[model samples]
Target chain A: MSLAPWRSRLTLALERNPQLNARYLQLATVGADNRPANRTVVFRGFYVDTDKLKFVVDARSQKITQIEQHPWAETCWYFPESREQFRISGCLTLVIANYPDLALQQARQDTWQELSDAARLQYTWPDPGQPKADAAAFESLPPNPKEPLPHFCLLLLQPVQVDHLELRGEPQNRWIYCRNDVNDWSTQAINP
Target chain B: MSLAPWRSRLTLALERNPQLNARYLQLATVGADNRPANRTVVFRGFYVDTDKLKFVVDARSQKITQIEQHPWAETCWYFPESREQFRISGCLTLVIANYPDLALQQARQDTWQELSDAARLQYTWPDPGQPKADAAAFESLPPNPKEPLPHFCLLLLQPVQVDHLELRGEPQNRWIYCRNDVNDWSTQAINP
Candidate 1:
């Protein structure tokens, strides 16, 4: 991933919404026969150095299966006030514990703090990732304390294409930016 | 469709926000490959007598194709002040003009006025409903004084499920209402 193009895209998105890093982003993955599945997760943080982005996922959600099937995904960040939207389509990678870092934990906590109590409860109990109480499956499973710990997994996305759509008046303004392997940005103006 | 369940879902959505009928809804549709495609359309008044909703759309958009191929689509309306969002997944209908209504035009014009001049100038032109160019597109096209007059097309939706997600604090709250029959509404709780 080229840092130049991503830096520009992230700068605009973050400038318009410094709080967006704390907002939830809806990640979509392709499903059977062209169908798509979506799930909203809090934004973990972005790594400008590695040109990567991270989010937590429960080990059991069907979304995990969808993500694993198709690593390519698109995310939408909708902002109401600015009537601005930032969309990116890219590839994802699941980060393992070998990536443990204090900085990443702090970033995760910052994003997590933005959620509501009920939202937190979804990840608070013995199993943070899956739907509550799978009686049929639970009866056959062994007792495991870490089961409820969300099996918290980190998913990273490296954006390949970014589009910024801003609504001001009649002819909406849109800027499309693409990143090349050489770490440069090519921009174009398209009719909105 | 079962009116009871549909109506219940609609009621839950409307009750959570009395202004839903007046607010703008952004519908996101994707191609068979799950690429992102979106358009801003109004929440054309819902049917009080039936489990249906309406919106004005240009036939040119790819959204029509996606909806035609796969009836399942999601619509989202975000309210920043309340830190709440309302989403629905449902089947769509291409409403013929024979449906008969005067408020339809009024609703469409009202929605248009909400758009900025640039957006209007760039994307919208006096509707001939046919493939006619904008003032600019027309100028580029050969002078043809004999083109057909513009027309408006209406799209309708029959919702199957509705989810209301409100973010209050550390956790979020969500309410799910499913349409069972014409007038039946089945309500359930889901993790936020």
Candidate 2:
């Protein structure tokens, strides 16, 4: 229940960079055929007070299948304003209908409720990565705000290793934090 | 060689975002134990007008080992000024001393000569990702700028798939360009 050592630095980054796009980060996963797949994913904030980072993905997205095959992922976030980067290596847990965790299932629902109407409607659109639909088909009707569609998934990234690099420094300050099996994190400053 | 379809958009992004950090991108790769690893890397530009994207890395970096194990990588670049994202997924080719490509070896030498003095000095410093060295040890002596050090490498990413997403649109615009084995590219407009 203790705070992650990098938490304060991440907090500082968020406070210093107020741009909405600052919340967007890159999520990289191993896809089918073991190809490295990456895309821009919105950072949905930490899961409660835990180190787990929250993100939402449509069940129909290729990332869902990629996660199913290989859950290991790395999230690279850069705050342009602060010129800092954070790369968190972790496994992603997709909260789907049959997923076992009831608490997480509830969290999924809560996350859905918190989404903007435009964002929620995206889940109602035709599946991503598919051939383009008609322009009219792109305009989707707003779905119910209180509940998530079956395909909407709350993805949680459980960080096992965190790398923070500050680009503003003389030689660029870099630190790596690794979590033990018991969840204790040890931090080390390394050459940038 | 013909240009990739996404090239123009990427060019426009660079033109609009004149910040030095605009060239910084995230490179994700499968590392030791099949875990995902990622970090920020500088984009060094195209290789002789080919589709390959260039980057530089030290031989002492962990990425070199990871590339030896799994060449697959994804480069995710976001242009905050233009609100555009480019994700290039491809396998990396390390142009080392023993690499067979003569042109690339020369390209490596050319790229080495183009680096700033400070950037070139980084390779002379203590190995990255290693335990923190003494402050005095951190100040490394400059190497010959005309020639790259033994461990300096030119990493080329031969992009097989290029995903360009424009976040400025209301629904966002995404296009994925895929290359066939013959190097012919086919593009698709997919739902964002």
Best by TM-score: 2
Report lDDT (Cα) of residue B98, candidate 2: 53
For candidate 2, write residues A91-173 as lDDT tens digits: 88999975698899889999999999888988877778787677777687899998789999999999999999988888789
Candidate 1 per-residue C-alpha lDDT over B48-167 given as tens digits, one digit per residue, 9 for 90 to 100: 456567766655555666776766656666554456666666777654333356665444445445444433333334322233234364223222222211333457677777777666
Lowest lDDT sum, 10 consecutive residues, model 2 chain A, at A131-140
Model 2: lDDT to the true structure: 0.88
For candidate 2, what is the DockQ?
A: 0.74
| Candidate 1 CAPRI category | incorrect
**Poorly placed runs, candidate 1 (over 4 Å):** A1-10, A18-22, A96-122, A126-150, A179-185, B1-26, B34-42, B95-152, B169-172, B180-184
Q: TM-scores across all candidates?
A: 0.67, 0.96
lDDT (CA) for every model shown?
0.57, 0.88
Question: Lowest-lDDT window of 10 residues in candidate 1 chain B?
Answer: B140-149
**Per-residue lDDT of model 2, residues B45-162, tens digit only:** 9998798899999999888999999999988998888888998988799999656888988999999999999899888888898887877876878889888998999999999999
TM-score of chain B of each: 0.62, 0.96
Check candidate 2 and list the clashing pairs.
none
